[model samples]
Target: RYDVDAIHMDDYFYPYPIAGTPFPDDRSFSRYAASQGFSSTQRGDWRRNNVNLLIQQIKYTIAAEKPWVRFGVSPFGIYRNKRSTPDGSGSETNGLQNYDDLYADIKLWVEKGWVDYNLPQLYWEIGHKAADYTTLLHWWNANNFEQPLYIGQDLKRSVDKNELDVKIRQSREMSFVQGNCYWYGYLMLDNYREVYDHLRSQTHRAKALIPAYTHMHKGRPAKVKKLADVFTEDMHFLTWEHPKQPRNPETAQRFVVYRFRKGERVDISRAENIVKITPDNFFVLPYESGKSSYTYVVTALDAFHNESKPATIKVKL
Candidate 1:
């Protein structure tokens, strides 16, 4: 009982919906079945097995990978149904749930100490008929995890002038839900200005990071060697090179460099960046320093936040 140290996890994978056939559970198991975990036709049971390995792997693997790190998942909220069973994790009207359809028994994971937290995707308006905030919220709070619980909200959904008002009020009304994760960071800028007010408000802002496993591996990165522009004063010029990435062995390889001036954070407020960053090989940084300086640094960022080592070039103004 006292052997383990921390929880570890991954996001919900394999999105729902089967094309023409139903969710391939029995079929998957029959065609590629190993020793059975449970004997049943309930597609939900097999689906649970699909995620069960993930949940178990998340726990043990985290212990193996980084024992001190905690793991959690933010599955689509509704857990299960009371009408179907005596004890389910949904409200009277809560629709098909993660446990039933998506086969994520997140609560079981929390209760069994398999996970450290559950960030339920509670992204609904306060009084919405199908999935009211008040009821589902209480359900989550009432069903406490041995770890912790957090809400993942759709802040962009609050961008509506009318809905934004209610969301602001609702934020003020809850306490036990702990903190929140705006569905995505861009939501902060996309939301109605008043919605920002609610987030910045004293009451809601007081609840900062919820206490949990805070340690994880963020690897040290390599440094920039040099930086210089290949393009001259000519406007539509382009230039690029690489360090770690292997270039063409049989032919001269081409590279595209997205240039920006020093000290320019990516501007998310607008549809694009403020200093006019471009993807066509090189970008013209319009600031005084950029116009004068020839040295510049370049880094890579994947569609996700996986950042790459910086490559640099040296030149004269």
Candidate 2:
């Protein structure tokens, strides 16, 4: 019953291997592998298939229940080493792989469109001995297959090496990489090495909307109606009404508020102009002395981040 935007699975599909000891799934494999047409020799394939089945089932369930809720995977950085794959469709780095070691066919899942997005955890520093961050970053970008790809960075490593700025800049340079997610977000909240200040003042100064899922739904929601300002002794706010229609893809799930100076053009496309994005229809206006007037534009956003036409209102203080 929780209202969640996405269902995410991290890199925990199977247990990491213990040296000189097997995974101890022999009994389960022996009991059910044959019924699925998997031979005893194909135990590894069977294990990968099990994870594949789970991914497919989750995709189907989300599509049926809430098509707007995206299904994404943050898999282990390396899919496979080149030496392990027959076709050599693997990265050059030699490391434990999601495909072989963890029995997760991440490439297959992405290619088959079974997941909405893939964020590979490349938690290594640049030019590392085993799994270099830049090497795997480029590898994932090349194999994204038009699916959204985000990088999962380790907060401590990036900050300690002073590569946080470098890594973010590198991802932005790549065409297919959409964004980056930090591991152990608390480090950022705690402002480790002033990383939070750096992001707020420089890298992420402008507000950005989540990328729209055009693959699922390409339609925009209807624009809001009756946009007006309300002024009272205790509070001054702007309020608008949703479009008169039944709840559907064309109905507003949230609203985007943008503010522009009196003489400036009302451009909703500019991320810097965005004041707030909220589910509530009302937005509290901050009082600013010496500011005589300002123009505010509100737009409706559907579940997929598609925005509607702007509803404008000018306030004179």
Candidate 3:
């Protein structure tokens, strides 16, 4: 009944085990284990399979109903410790793992394409005793399994330790780590430790479009048409016509407006050049007294963020 861009799952899969007490699931497991063809010795496998089935069912159901909506999971930072895995596919950290403690096979989910994206919550400091942030960051980047990998940063820990900027720079350096999601939105919005200032002035200086889901739909929408300027009393507006009705991925659901000085080269690839990304076909132009001439380029973006060709218009004051 409601439309959403994506469905996301957080790190809480199975509860952390209590010391000296096993999970009281023997009766339930015995009832359905044989029907599912699981032996008593495969209890751990059965637990992992339960979570796996949930992931697969959600993916399939979303695809059947709304194919455009993406499914992503943010699992615990450590998939497994090297000491636990004989194949040496795990990280070097000595921490509670998603595989052993939580019974979440996040790596298998990513490899099987059950989740569209994987974001590991690496909330520890750079050189934490149990789970070093950098160590797990590099580990996740290497084992992304050809899926989009984003880092889940704990805002308080990063700000308190004065390593937020360093972590951002480090993630940018890794080729496979696409982005970072700050945990606890209220802290950032409240400007905890000047994080909001840091982001606005340094890290996130310019507007940016969300990464396009090219793996799902690579086709670009049709370019916008009839680009022109409109004047209403004292307001200057840039307007364009939609290439097609905004009903599907092939039509324009949003537009990207980029402004450049008359002598400057037009480059839409630069996020700094982006003026506004809006669903409206008209943009209210901000008049500058000294700037008499400017060049503006507009492009159409579909729901999947697939961009169309440029529609250029030069405006004279």
- Ranking according to lDDT, highest score first: 2, 3, 1
Error of 1 at 64 (Å): 2.1
Q: What is the Å distance of residue 313 in model 2 from its true position?
A: 3.1
Higher-TM-score candidate of 1 and 3: 3
Query: Residue by residue across 1-317, what tens digits does model 2's lDDT show?
Result: 66788999989998999899999888999999999999989999999999999999999999888878899999999999988889988888999999899999998998988899999999999999988999899999998897889999998999999998999999999989989999889999999988899889999999888887777788888778999999899888999999533236557888999999889988887999998999899999988883579999999888878888899999965
Q: What are the lDDT scores of the predictions, listed in order?
A: 0.53, 0.90, 0.89
Name every residue pair that clashes in candidate 3.
Answer: none
| lDDT accuracy of residue 51 in candidate 3 | 92
Q: After superposition, how far is residue 154 of candidate 2 from its true place, in Å?
A: 0.4
Can you give the lDDT of residue 115 in candidate 3?
A: 90
CA deviation > 4 Å runs, candidate 1: 1-14, 18-20, 25-27, 31-34, 40-43, 87-89, 159-176, 190-194, 201-317
Residue 31 local lDDT, model 1: 57
lDDT of 1 by residue, 1-317 (tens): 34333442434554565657675445677754345654545445766777777788767866675454566778776676567566543565557677766677877787877776777877777677878766676777777553467777776665552454454455445554545667667656764555667667732543221242322223322332334445456542324533433221211112223333345543232222222233234555433434553434444322112234556554333
Candidate 3 displacement at residue 21 in angstroms: 2.3
lDDT of 1 at 51: 78
- Each candidate structure's TM-score, on Cα atoms with residue i matched to residue i, is 0.55, 0.92, 0.96
Query: Which pairs of residues have clashing backbones in candidate 2?
Result: none
Across 72-142, the per-residue lDDT of candidate 3 in tens digits comes to: 99898999999999998889999899998999999898898889899999999998989999999999999
